[model samples]
Target chain A: MDERLLEILEDIQPEVDFETCTTLIDDHYLDSLSIISLVAELEEEFDITIPTVEIIPDNFNSAEKMWEMITRLSEED
Target chain B: MFSIVTYFSVEALLLLLVTALLYACLPQKLRRWVLLLASYIFFYSISGKLLAYLLFSTLSVHHIGLWLADVQNECAAQTKGLARDERKALNAVYQKKQRKIMGFACFIHIGLLVLLKYTPFFSENINTLLKLAGSSFKLQIPKYLIPIGISFYTLQAVAYLFDVYRKKIPADRNLMRLALFMSFFPQLMEGPICRYSDTAVALYDAPKMRYDNFVLGSQRILFGLMKKLVIADRLNLLIQNVYAEPNKYDGFIIALSAVGYTFQLYADFSGTMDLVIGAAQMFGITLPENFKRPFFSATISEFWKRWHITLGTWFKDYIFFPVSMSKPMKKLTTQARKKLGNHYGPLIAGAVSLFCVWICNGLWHGAGWNYIFFGMYHFALILGGNIAEPVVIKITQKLHINRASFPYRCIQIARTFILVCFGELFFRAEGLKSGIKMFCKIFTDFTFASLKSGSLFKCGMDRQDYIIIIVSAILLFVIGILQEKGIQIRNSIAKKNIAVQFAVYYALILFIIIFGAYGAGYVPLDPIYAGF
Candidate 1:
């Protein structure tokens, strides 16, 4: 799951080091348009819905945060 | 109707002092009531009978919140012990019901705002259309005594409703808690637009006044006064004259005034926020910061994020994300990504959402073609920038120009500022036609004849006034640079010796007293955002 998520992140923004950098949204690495692409990619890959409420900076700021949210959401589903 | 004119007025200061005193003397539990009553009094003084509008909004929001809470409770009870599939199905049914209720709530709340605020603008446009159609019939345009800060508070109320519906926040059962949040006197006029989860409980708690907070808050308030009195009001003398009659001036004068108007607006609106947030801080409630050195922004999109930040976030959360993430838009995003690749793919859905957000943003400021033009102007710039990004990057790479270099970043900032100033020119013009004429004159009759002849200072601002404005702007720019570097001026000051702190305060007060625009020949721009 982590590898796939990193692959998607790299595919969207090739310049960003998705492993070490955590301020993706905060630093403008992942803007609204990027997030749109990301959410669609994540849902398709993981088969879990990402609601608008969960699209906050904390969830997508890092790969770990995104993984945690995906795992928690999938369990809830 | 009362002596309290604006937050900067002596009368308003007296009201704040008296309220602070009362709040301090009151029991911890009763402190919230004092705040609530003071908020109502403040509203009543400004809007008079229009206070009823605020009361109605508060009560309606309170009731709707409870209703939504009740619906949630019923759903929880019904879904108990159900299997996963059944529970999901039941939740969907309940969600539909909640959506219907949310729709009605918005109708009542947003409906009242539209009817009150936009009726005249809408009717006038309709009448023009009718006249064009060769019809004699006309709609009667009615004037409304719009409650001061209705625009600000209405957004707050709707945000509350949305938060409750999303279950991000449990709907408040306490009326006074919600009321205090909605009508919190400090942020009532021009807001940083506090969220329920962030502010409601803080207002209810009404923490005891601390000495550090008092000093820090007072310092902030004084800084706000410096911005408003020394800069915003002073610039008003030039901006008002130029905007009121753009054709009377050349493009140079018009352009200068546009930049002046932009500064005036920043100082005016952000100054008000400083006062608002500072006042709230004195009571130990930390409202969200609104302005974040917007002039330093590298793009129009970044400018929006930095300036009037709360409003930007509100639209992002409530409008942009929702529209973009809706089922159809989601599907569009998925398909587009495959076809257009990562960058341009989701842009199709994003553009649609951006359009909706901008249109609402334009109308939200006021009902005018110029305001709408301002919105579309920005929309075009942002979308154009996004579309051109790859090409620009490739071109820069080919030219061996490092985008991260200081010179490059400075160029970006400068370009963004010019674009923003142009938008403000349209925003501040008397009408769309006048705005166009003024813009055209900049190119058609471009000359520095006024400066050569020294007539530039003759219109509203004299030589001395110009000198003072330049010095004050330099001061503001230095301060902005420090703030951008993450230096908290107030905290730094607080850590200084008592004498230094006092000197800083006294210097600020003296500056305002010496150069503040008031008394005669100058009308301080009426709280700019208040009209919106």
Candidate 2:
């Protein structure tokens, strides 16, 4: 899941190193536009809805966090 | 019964001191009451009968929050143990109901703000249209005594309601907590636009005022005072003159005033934030910061993120993401991405939402065409940056430029500053037309004759005044650099001896007293953001 998530993130912003790097939002690696693209891709790839309420930095700051959120949200779904 | 014009005023300081004293002496339960009472007193002192508007907003937000919560609770109870399809059906029904309530809540809260703040602007536009249509009818524009902090607190009210509807936070049952959150005196005037999750519980807890907190809070307040009195107010002399009679000066002077107005705004607004956060700190409550050395930003979008940070977050959360992530926009993003590739795909929808954000951002500042133009100006800048990002990246890479290198970042920062100063020019201009004329004069009538003849000092700032402003600016810049580098000056000072702390405090006081723009011949700038 982490690998898949990294793929999606890199697809959205290839310049960023999604594995080791956190602070994606904090460091401006993934801005609002990136978030928009990432959200749409994550929903389609993972078959889970990404609600706006969960669009905070903590959830998308890293690939690991993104995977955690995806798994948790998928289970909830 | 006395009125206080700003947090910088002696009356406000006295009020804060007296309240802090009362809060410290009182029992824990009574401290919250003291805060509530002091908040009401501060509101009444400013707007008098208009306090009713704030009271009405508080009560309505409290009631609507609970109403939405009740629906959510009911939906949860019914949805339990149901089949997935049936549960989804019930959830949709409840969401629709809650959405209606949220819409109505926004109508009551944001509607009041629009009516009170924008009625005259709307009426004048309509009258112009009526005239343009060759009609004799003129709309009778009514004057409104707008409540103080209506703009700041209305956003708070709407944010609270939205949070409740979204289930980000449980609906706060205690009206007193909600009331305090809504009307917290320090932030009620000009906000960092705090969230319920940020300060509500901390305020209700009303921690005992420790000596360190008191001293630290006082130090912060004094720092804010220096920023306001020494810099923002001093710059006011030039800014007010150039902006008022923009036609009186050449573009060089106009450009200087634009830069002056931008710095004045920063000092004024950020200084007020310092006072607000400091006052909250005295009560052992912390408010979110509204600024992060915005001038250091390398892009207009980055500038917005760093400046008036809370308001930007509010628009991002409430306006930007919601609009962009809406069903149609999401679908637009999905479809566009497949066709246009990753970056430009989401940008189409992002631009749509960005436009909405900037329009609200502009009008949220005030109800004027210039404010709208200010919003659109940034919107265009941000959107243009977005469009040019790929090209810039390609060019920089081809040119062997390290985008993250110091010299390149410096150029970016300088470029962003010039753009921001122009935006502030429009923001501070009398109206849209004046802003445009001043902007045009920058190119058409550009010259340094005023500086060559030494007549530049005569407008409102003198040679001595210019020197003082320059020295103060350098001081602020050093402090900003330390802060950006993660040096906590206050905390570092706190670790020092008591004598050192007091010396720092007294130096700030004496600085304001000596070079401050208060005595005769200096008309202090009014609280700029408070009007917004």
Candidate 3:
């Protein structure tokens, strides 16, 4: 777990524990636009292009999920 | 002008007969073409010569797009296998040619739009300026009639050029497909602002001629009619009266009228979108969704995101991002941050984007000063929120107050409502001066005691009318709530037993037929967004 990623999560959801908070979409923590904004921020931070089709909730619903998605994208690049 | 008599009594029957005939006679691929033709004829029946302008604009853009694509392909080929200097020279020529073509296309398209929509405003302003200079100049306000779908098609055409430029989609080769994209009759008058990419597939696909599509489309159209006639038009009478003379009303009454206009505009616009999209669906084309439980939005930004989704997206993509991300704007932001510190950069950027969007939005509605003020009013609210967001968050943190607490959320919602009402005051006002007068009257002559005196209903609506408005508004709100919770009303109904489904359908039809503000002494009001 990257400390910078933790810091970003804290900025978005100050009260929630980044490690514990899962199922972001199911919990309704972020709507579609919010998710897009987050993805854009993550792409800028990590220097990776998140494919448009990979932006679905299934791949972005949790910290672990997002990390996995980003890792995959980075690896593909 | 042809004095075409509109017989609402025969409209449904005629539509049904035509729909049936098209379904029975036309082959799969040809039905959509027939529908497209029918749509043009329908628009021509209302707009006459203006329809010819629409056709010309559509055909011109279609041909230009195809030509531009060829030029782009040629440029790509020429750039390949060239030395650096030669490549640069070739690229410059290509760029210059592309720019000329695009500039010419945009000039012609937007020229027609301005001539048709803004001539009166331009003439009046020029005359006023001339008079101020003591010239006493009199200019004839050109009597150019605007086509019914000029604004919509213009936007679509511009979007096509943009799409081609960005290489989001290939320039459409088929003239008929491009024509259908522009003149799809359902969205011709008022739009969800159909995009080339969003609707191209459904528009070009050979029509399936399925019974299911027809039934579903009919049901959707019925739902749209119910929302528009039964709820929106009925509420319009009350809204118009209070807004017409805001001085005679108290703050509460004026506020109520503002709220009423909100509902009326939403229902009228969304209902029309539904009808248009549904009609397109009948021809096996699915137009973009325009509304999605907008009132449930917790923030002003969220409300905009949900309300008029298509138009908002269009503005965001075509106007806001471009202006915000422009080189000059970026340079200014960088300089400002270095001089004024990091805090001011976001604020300045936001203000620039907000101003651009609002000015364009206001002018897009019409040339009236009221519309301009309406645009600025919202611009101020949205910009103010963006500026104050960090300050508010800091204050809450310092006070140890929970930002997402229920009480805080309630306060935010209440403030948003107030801000929205104030903006709507300008939107519904007759002119800029009247908007100011009515706004001042809100505080000067406000009396809450008089609100309960039953004088509010006297504003062109009787007791029964008020009752109907309130009831229908409640119904509208209830349905909106259901939708906000992600309950797909149509799909839910489809999932029900056949008997129950039929019963609900019959009930909806009966409600619309009996309670609708159409037929028998009712003058049908044009869909409000058609003016834009």
Q: State each candidate's chain A TM-score.
A: 0.96, 0.94, 0.85
> What's the lDDT for all of these models?
0.91, 0.92, 0.74
Model 3 lDDT per residue over A8-74, tens place: 6665556667687787777767543344345545766787655444655787677888888888876
- What tier of docking accuracy does candidate 1 attain? medium
**Real contacts recovered, all predictions:** 0.68, 0.68, 0.00
What order do you get sorting by lDDT, best first?
2, 1, 3
Measured with C-alpha atoms, the lDDT of residue B283 in candidate 3 is 66
Per-residue C-alpha lDDT of model 1 across residues A1-77, encoded as one tens digit per residue: 48999999998999998899889889989988999988988988998888788999999889889999999988665
Off by over 4 Å in 1: A2-7, A15-21, B1-3
The alpha-carbon RMSD values of the candidates against the true structure, listed in the order shown, are: 1.4, 1.5, 5.0
lDDT of 1 at B62: 96
lDDT of 2 by residue, B257-326 (tens): 9899899999999999999999999999989989999999999988988999999999999999999998
DockQ, 0 to 1 scale, candidate 3 = 0.10
i-RMSD of all predictions: 1.3, 1.4, 8.1
Q: Tell how far residue B430 is off in model 1, in angstroms.
A: 0.7
Query: By the TM-score metric, which is better: model 1 or model 3?
Result: 1
- Arranged by DockQ with the best first, the candidates are 1, 2, 3
